[model samples]
Target: MTFEFEDRKHENTQLPNNLSAPNPGHTHQLISIMNTQKRDRFELLSAYLDGEVTATERRQVEEWLDKDVETQRLYSRLLNLRSNFQSLPVPSAQPVEQTIGQVFGKIDKRRRHRSVAWGGAAIAAMVVAALSSVVPGRQVWQMANVNNSAASEPLYVALNTPVVEIPDTVLAPAHKSAPAQPAKLHQQNN
Candidate 1:
C-alpha cells in the first residue's frame, strides 16, 4: 500500500491543536517521513511474522495491524503466501560425496580432451615448421647449383659526374688550432 503526497496532505488538513497547513518545502519532508514510517512498519511486521521480534515490537505490530485495515489485509496475504510455500514439496538432494566425485570425474575428462587437442596442435606446428624450412633450404640449394655463365659477364656501374682528383692535402683534416679551409674543386655543370 502506498500513501501519496496528496493523501497525506489531506490528512494534514484535519490536524489538531489548530496547527497551520504545511508549507511547500515542509510538504516534501512530511512525505519522506511518511514513506520511512511505512517502510519501518512493514519491516517490523515481517519480523513479527517470522517470530524474530521482541515482545514490545510484536505488541507494536499487533496494535498497528488492529488500527490499519490495509496492514491487516497485507498481513493476511503474507500469512497465506507463507503457508503456500511451506506446503510445497521439498526436492531431494544427491549425496555430497557422490556429487563431488561426479564433478571431479568431469574435470578429469575435460583435462584429457584438452591434453589430446594440445598434443595434436604441437604435432601440426612441428610439421608446418619442417615443411617451411625444407622448402626454403631446397630452393637455396637449387639456386646455388644453377649455371655460372650468366654470372661471368663483368658488372659495371656508370655515373654522369666527371671524376676530378683533389690533392690529398686538400682532403686531409686540419688541426683544430688552425681553422679548416673548404676544398676548391673544378666541375662541369649541366
Candidate 2:
C-alpha cells in the first residue's frame, strides 16, 4: 500500500469561498496584546475608583468606559460591588470583660479535662503498681499485714464464715487494768 502525507501549511490557503483563514501566530499575539491592554485599563479604572488617579487619568478612564460597552458594564459591576461592601454591617466591639471571661472559660475547661485525664492515668498507674507488688495466690489483706507481728495478725475471716462469741473472761485483758478517775486538790490553811 502507498501512503501520502498532506501538507498542513497550504491547507487553509485555498478555500471554496475564497476566504483566507487568520494566521495562528497573529491570532495568539493579538489575544495576548488585548489581554494586556485590558488588564492595564482595569488597573487604571481601579485606581480611579479608589480616588488615587490624577484629573487627566480620570478623564482618560471616563472616555474609555464611555466608548466601550464591556468596560462600562465591568465598571458598573465594580461600583455595585464597592457599594455592597460599604453597605455591609460593621461588627460592634464586644465588652472586654465578657471577651476575657469567655477566653478564660475555654482555657479552664481544657485544663480541667487535662487534669481529669492525668488523674485517671495516675490512678491506673497506682492500681498497676499495687497489683504488681502483690504475691501470687495471696489475699490483698495478707499483703497489708506483711510487716505486722504474729500477735497482732490481721483477721482471716472468710465471706461465708460463721460469727463466734467468746466469754467475757477470755475477752478481758490478761493484765490488771487501772480505772481512770479525776484527782481532787486539798487546800492548805496557814
Candidate 3:
C-alpha cells in the first residue's frame, strides 16, 4: 500500500475564483476603515494575516479588505515586498583591516596633535615658573647674612621690607641735608 501526504481533495474542489477576490460593492466599507486613523488598513491587514486578531476583528478586517480595492492592492504590495526582501542575498566578507587602519590613522593623528598641545602647555608652565622666580617685583623677602664683631657669620634671616624708602629730608628742600647734621650726631649717640 502506498500513502500520500498531500491533500488531493483540496486540489479537486471546485472553489469559485471570486472567493478570494474583493467584492466590488465593499468599497464604501473600505473607505470607512481607511478614514479611521486610529488603525491604518495596512496594520489591520497585517495583524489579520498573522492571525493575531480576535474572531470579530478578523471578520471586520476581511470585510474591509474585500470591499476596498486600494487596501487589497496595498496588502498585496506589502506581501510582495516582504517576499523580495527575504530573497535578498546576505553579504559574507567584510573589509575589517582597511576600516581598522583608517580608524587607527585618525587616532594616531589626534594623539600627535594632543601631544604637541601638551608639550606647548608644559613649556608655557616652565616659562611662567622661571619668570616668577626672576622678576624683581615678586621678590617679597630675601635671605640675608649678618656680620658680627667684623667677622663673617652666616645667618638665614627673612627680611620682608620695601627695597627703598623716601626720607622726609629728601622730600624737603635740598638744603635740608645740612640742617639734619645735628640730628645725625644724636642718632649716632643713640
- The prediction achieving the highest lDDT against the true structure is 1
> Which residue pairs come into collision in candidate 2?
none
How does model 1 fare in lDDT? 0.71
Local distance difference test values of all predictions, in order: 0.71, 0.71, 0.67
| TM-score preference between candidates 1 and 3, better one | 1
Flag regions of model 2 displaced more than 4 Å: 1-32, 127-190
Ten consecutive residues with minimal summed lDDT in candidate 2?
1-10
> What is candidate 3's lDDT per residue for 1-190, written digit by digit as tens?
0011122212433334444458865655555544643244556667766677666667766786789787788778878888898899997776999889999999999999999999999999999989888888675577797767566655555568545765767565775446558878899999
The candidate, 1 or 3, that scores higher on lDDT is 1
TM-score for each predicted model, relative to the true structure: 0.50, 0.51, 0.35
Question: Candidate 1, which segments miss by more than 4 Å at Cα?
Answer: 1-24, 53-59, 130-190
Ranked candidates (TM-score, high to low): 2, 1, 3
- Candidate 2 residue lDDT tens string, 27-81: 6666665675666667777777998776667777788788999889889989999
